[model samples]
Target: MTDKNPDKGFVALLGWSLNAIEAVDRFDRRYVVVAPPWAEDYCRQNDIPFVPWDFDRLNERSHELALTLEDMGVDVAIPIFEETVEWAGAVNAVLLKNPRLLGQAMLFRDKSLMKRRAQLGGIRVGVFEEAHDRGDVIRFLKRVNQTLLKLDGDPNDPIHFKAFDKSGTAGHRVIRTPEDVDNIPDEEFPALLESHLDGWEFAVEAWIKNGKIEFLNISEYVTLGYSVFVPATPELEAHRERITEEIEKLIEVFDIDFGFIHPEYFLTSDNKLYFGEVAYRPPGFNALELIERAYGFNGYQGLVLAFDPKTTQEELDAFFPKEVVDAKGHAGCFGVYPRRRVVSRLQVPEETANHPYFEFHELSDPREQKVAKRSAFGTHWGLAYFFGDNAHDLRDLLKRQEELDYYV
Candidate 1:
């Protein structure tokens, strides 16, 4: 329990979350937080030194984070979540200008910028357009002729729609045909429409350091009957290798010297690889921990070491398990609140409370109405994470929980 002195070394994690990274752990180098002030209590409880900043403006926020860290004598910064993307470039701009500060975070935000950079490096990426309004959506759809149109579309297209500002299953809707357009209001919603891939969805996890890409882990996602999570099988290995190779090329192209990325891919029946989307930060489903288990590398540790090139991979390995079992994989499922406009006090097997891999379980009551947001393609409420010896076992475990049944 040695103190992390700012003068010695410290890392800054932005967009704070309790479970994703060890931002507040005692063993971490002195930690400086660039998050809302409300998180100060959590920092104090964990003995982690922190510096709070506003999120109103990305540039200003970045500058402020740098100034705060410098005042505290911190030499390096590593962001833990994506919310910090808004200001990452500005912070890196500051660091790049000042000689000694380490680590860069610009490629993590702005999908259009990342993809353009990736393509230049020879990484095959799906055609994509950044749409900010209804007009943008229409224009992009017209250009692609295969709009995964999200707003004001016919309800019969079987297209799923979502807004840019929305996360964790919010701001999602489906447009089945032209008639469904009438159901949406005329107000603008920042959304993107892309051709949907009808195949297995996969998330490839990697850590890039000094332009070298290390494939950390891969997860096979079954989005058919449900979005189930499992370890990658042999059928997905080739696709994973190809994607990994392409991602490595992207790293060299982008000069992503030090960071983690979650690039999602789709493998069709013919094994044709299709890029889905990429997130510069860690995956959303607490999947980082799984990565740590599978690769025997502490993603958070590697993140910290990315700045200090001298830090050995051995040190990172010491922080993670040497081997992870496919049987130890986890399944994640989501269930919405009751579909009625009243209080939905449903009950379930209390055993769910003790499930080993139940990473998160909660009830969304934003409107105080028991009814959850209605949508065919978006998750409504109540998510469960459980591990099993295999994908089927995990799925069956979720089914048996019977905790997700709806009630008005």
Candidate 2:
């Protein structure tokens, strides 16, 4: 059967995920976008067609969107938000019902399922126990305590702690004591009690197409914080080949399809690698651009292409280079506004903007009102993107930007 659709072209659903959609824009094909309602004006200005869709409500909204787009015969539905992962199953349901659709979505939301599936396929991940409250926490902590505690130790020996759940960083906490254990709120804790990895962090970036894993790059996390990602050095680099092989195994075992994945891991002092976490989307850092800088192909753009049936994975892989992609200069990093807080103003001197190292910057208008932070949901108030041939220059500029306080 020939894969040709004269009437139905490609359609892409994007939320506030500007980078992913913009990356998709690099392709020659036309894209019909289903995005946040707020994006309508931006779409109009950019000459991209806009369809209203709420990324917040996945089951209902996505199912509704699936049906609506079914009529339009969209070839692809890609989500930019981590939250939209809930729609993965729903979209899969629709895709299964209609096999013509390009991909399947599963294990994208629940971290436990994601890890369990990966481990069964030989993926090296952290040892995690799913816990509910004090009982679960206590039981799991006891196990960790027994394993780590030394003989003739103090009766009140402190225990290092970590956690796992659906939420990122928020789902994790450092538990130092029994008292600290109790501090874990019932509502906030979902899956808990994970043994902390002592080694440095590395991220395996890949694209799974037709059950094939294309290992793009392994990124080491130099500095991790509220909103910063620095690169890892060669010494810090961990099991790139093993991780890639295992991930490929998981893709087949799980039956995942054309999509971008970021699998995080930690290497022990002995060089033993442990899985940390995985995101079904692109890297939080503009790691794609960095990868592209190192390799001629665009990692983010390849992700977008994976959604289009006309674009084959082989074609995408051919475009990527064999060597590790690196930033041109020494040390550099990127940061988001601290927390969910609003960006009252992102004050950057014009000099910084004109700098060759300064790749991009974004700011939320503080204006008359304060930037809101603690809400269950809100977009980034401001973002500052920096890129320099010299990593040191980028680092220095970030240091200067960090000193300025947000008014709200």
Best by TM-score: 1
Which residues of candidate 1, in runs, are more than 4 Å off? 1-8, 20-28, 41-46, 96-107, 130-174, 179-190, 224-230, 290-299, 307-310, 320-343, 349-369, 375-382, 395-408
How badly does each model clash, as a count of residue pairs? 9, 6
Provide the lDDT at 187 for model 2.
71
Candidate 2 lDDT by residue in tens digits, 1-408? 123345433646555666656665765555667766888898889866678877766354666777776667666666666665556446645744644222234465667677787778776766677776677767766676677764544453333333342434544556646676776666765664566667666677777666666555666554443233333344443355666665676567556666777777777788676766677776655667666654556665576566566675467666555544433433334454543244444455666566676665555555644445432222334556655454345445666655545333
Q: How far does residue 349 in candidate 2 sit from its true spot (Å)?
A: 12
Question: What are the lDDT scores of the predictions, listed in order?
Answer: 0.55, 0.58
Worst 10 residues of 1 by lDDT: 98-107
**What local lDDT does model 1 show for residue 152?**
45
Candidate 1 local lDDT, 1-408, one digit each (tens): 445544434666766766534534545466566777888888788765566666655454467676766676565556566666545545655544642222234444544565566666666666665555555554544444445443544432344445543333344555444444345444425454554456777777677666665445667665432344545554565465576666776566656666677776767777677665566666665566555444434556556665543456665545534223423444455343454567646544456656665555565444464554555344445555555445565555655644445443
Evaluated against the true structure, the overall lDDT of model 2 is 0.58
